[model samples]
Target chain A: MSAKTWLPLLALAALTGCRQDMHDPPRYRAQGSSDFFSDGRVNRPVVEGTVARGQLRADTKFYQGREGGEFVKTLPVELTKDLVKRGQERYNIYCSPCHGMVGDGEGMVVQRGFRHPPSFHLERMRELPVGHYYDVITNGFGAMSSYASRIPVKDRWAIVAYVRALQLSQNATMQDVPEAERGKLSQEGRQ
Target chain B: MSQIFHPSANTIAKVSIFGAIFFAGGLLVILNEVNRSPYVTRVGVAREQPVPFSHKHHVGGIGIDCRYCHTAVETSSAAGIPPTETCMSCHSQIWADSPMLEPVRASFRTDRSIEWTRVHDLPGFVYFDHSIHLKKGVGCVTCHGRVDQMPLMYQQNTLNMEWCLDCHRAPEKYVRPREEVFRMDYRPQESQQVIGARLVKEYKIRKLTDCSVCHR
Candidate 1:
């Protein structure tokens, strides 16, 4: 009836026509299992109910560590090492811009304009366990978004484990290292 | 007091009391029926759907994943109801002849979403994140019951506090491999409790017994 309304309806009709055109061609797919599964192909999207093939999690005895042993432990997840490495790389990509290269909260973004996050080593977090660290990374403790979608579960754990490594390295003392290693370092530096 | 034979008066009094008791019993039964799941009853009264889209048929018989039809469990904030296109994916081949499926075809042409009544629901504030639960290895059956076996999927489990606490207190009882976690009727395929127990200890789980663990 109105000129404003007619223009919008005309535009909407064009948009629907465009969508109908797009659907006319099978441009996208659900990425179901293809040759990539058995042929050592990469990036297979595991849909629901598609018996997880070669899932690293399969046969992983429920334990804290990676093995099925007498003693119980936290998940030494199948991706424990791989995830940690990926996390470090991803952290460098997505987080290092703000949380610093080492998660000390002195990232380039913070230096430039963004608010600094607490160093993962700070008292508030030094006492925090891996779950707390993971929660923060996933949900963003403060001024952060949920990386729940961005980071997969296994990778988040890896980042948490890596953060622990960073903390350990920063707080290391001479006694903490092997005496033989310290001797080599001292000698190498002196000579 | 019995100067005259009061047998007729006595009979009338007995009939009056008996009639009153019968009326009360009938009223009680009617009230009980009205009290049971007031929501579904109102739905039965109004909004006549063109086809009886039984969740029981899809979930119970064919063992279709809710996400298969809902389709938004992972990426979106809302797990969207199935569009006619999603239904036509199967119905176009399977139920092409059924008059019941006529509504589905009509819906596709009309571009309308099927208004399937949500049977099991929670308060909006409760904020149940299906994705988070999925990530934690909480199986669909933990809340939904054995949906794949239903002919007409009905709400089997009451989403009450105690029901949730029973699972949360013993997450190992419910937690399964992430792959099978979406299964609507998956019991632990193996003994994960021993490993689950160790994880509980190793992780230094502080709040198994705490209310906030599940309530929050």
Candidate 2:
């Protein structure tokens, strides 16, 4: 072939060489081997007393939901309307799938044949301290996994407060509603 | 003196000219085909998996929420694959003897995870978080197309960097209400731009153009 005819083919060959297919870079995969470390593991163990940034977790009552080996009776955070609202939203997204919107433990997951969790309306559940809920969420119970990774610390407290509200809701009597609100209930009754 | 016969150069020139044109046109056609080929984009190609899990039957027919299987989408970076227990929760009682679900049963018994083939894989350089996207009001249908219609899951978008930047540059065009994020069939009641602009302010969304935002 003439030089001119071969020029185009040469260009195509050169272009093909420039492909970006080098995906596996020199990096360690999870639990990969390492030559630099004496232990031969890619991940190094945390140094003694080395706390990750923003993970000091000094407040035992707030982090661990306990004081002197007993669950705290009161919520660690300040209760507010917004906090409960946030809790309601978070609860529907996370807890409601298995615990039901009313905390009756008849969630969609259970309807699909998963183990049924006890209803919050039970006397045993209602009598349990707020910290007990926090502990269960922080470190799972029965077949349920720990939600600590999924729910942040403050959100966990918020969910605990919402669960308490749910317990009160199922057990509430006519006296629980104010006299003014009672009229609204009777108005709906007429309809 | 002898009259020398000259070869016809005209025919050679015409042939070379036509050949070059034909080669260029053929090259263009081939390149275009390669660009849209299934091998490159994988759009509409249903990949084989260990289990033939049908999103159509599960999501559309059975009316299961996306979060039921992808439990960690709201909080974690990854939309986690459901564990064997999630399948056995239903299959154990319903399709207990079905040969198709034997893999699920085996996985549950062995406590081994099913090696599901990833469909919408992004390059290692790009970091995409499901939580931030869902929290920002991007619907499941926005990038995934109509997944409820797919019997077997397949990638619906090119998922190229250019495709990603098209939305990130102007998120208001695609953003929906937080409640509507999981609604697979959700359509904007008003113009998307008007709703998106309001949500942009409400959600405090800023236009992120920095390479480090995703590249890092």
Candidate 3:
């Protein structure tokens, strides 16, 4: 075919090819339940009682009337047999190997070759609010890695409660022992 | 005939005219969309598993947390599968009498990691952190899809780089409470626009409209 005869064909091809743009805008779909508005003015419902995760730092206070970077939710946990049992189970699973069953940092890993994890009964840790331990577990202390993912949030709190109980175990003296338990303790060999 | 061809002005004009037309046409095509064939990387569906494991069952059913199975996701670089030891913890007593437990037991002996076929894979060039996502309130279902309903878990989302950038472009719109961590259908209770505005001011979020926010 002569070159002149192909001009219309090339022009037609160019027109078709030019319209073949692959970047068409997506269809705007309607949102239900929670709406995503495009305009700057819109309302959002922030969860009333939840804290933002991955954002809470040691320097920020999460408790009432505290305006510092430190977390302030520190209160002795209420004693419950089930809570203690749960605490013990979690402790055995994650902590016993390094801190021992009794919180002395003498578990199997330490016995074999791991470095010593500090005893929970140390005065500095003992006096620290439960949140202190929580932070350490979530963020990790010296030579330790964060356990936030290994243990669930509630379980870590439970483990902290269990650690307090272990700390008290070393502090218990004659007056602290209950009469019923003391009788059983004092009569250990007689029976 | 040779002398006649040399003196023909019509022949010279015709050839020049065609040449000019072809050159302009080529230029116009190039100026438009005259690109070479694109390079697309496509590895099709991987081999199916012997026994389908459901993200629906463990994560959706029985309320077993993601940490129960993929335990290392939070602290370690890898989000790993539970060892046979983790499985045996409950299976030792719970499923000892079941016939299906045999494959699990066999897997333990072989030291295989269940081969749990990966469905949601991202390109190697991209870096994602499960801990950060989980902590920041991106649910498992956000990208994994309705895992609770599936028996055997497969990749739920395409997980292409564009797919990731879609959310990164406007995170507040996609982000929700940590409680909704895996539910893809979850929407922020308030309007995304309002939340985004509040988030910018409250959290001091520096950049949202920036391309580098998602891309390297």
Candidate 3 similarity to native, TM-score:
0.44
The reply for model 3, stretches above 4 Å from the true place, is: A1-157, A160-191, B1-47, B97-99, B182-187, B200-216
> How close is every model to the real structure, measured as TM-score?
0.39, 0.74, 0.44
For model 2 chain B, where is the 10-residue window of minimal lDDT? B86-95
Give the best candidate by DockQ: 2
C-alpha positional error of residue B75 in candidate 1 after TM-score superposition, expressed in Å: 3.6
> What stretches of model 2 exceed 4 Å from their correct place?
A1-18, A22-58, A178-191, B1-16, B52-115, B127-131, B148-151, B204-216
Tens digits of lDDT, candidate 3, B140-173: 7677667666766555555656567677666766
Give the higher-TM-score candidate: 2 or 3. Answer: 2
By descending TM-score, how would the candidates be arranged? Answer: 2, 3, 1
In candidate 1, stretches whose alpha carbon ends up further than 4 angstroms from where it belongs are A1-191, B1-50, B198-216
Interface RMSD of 3: 16.3
Report residue A188 deviation for candidate 2 (angstroms).
Answer: 5.7
- Residue A67 of model 2 has an lDDT of 92
lDDT of 2 by residue, B1-216 (tens): 865544666787789999999999999999888987888889889999988999998777656778766877888777877767667545656667889888998888875566678788777677789999998888989999888999999999989787899998999999999999998899899998899999999998888979999989
The order by descending lDDT is 2, 3, 1
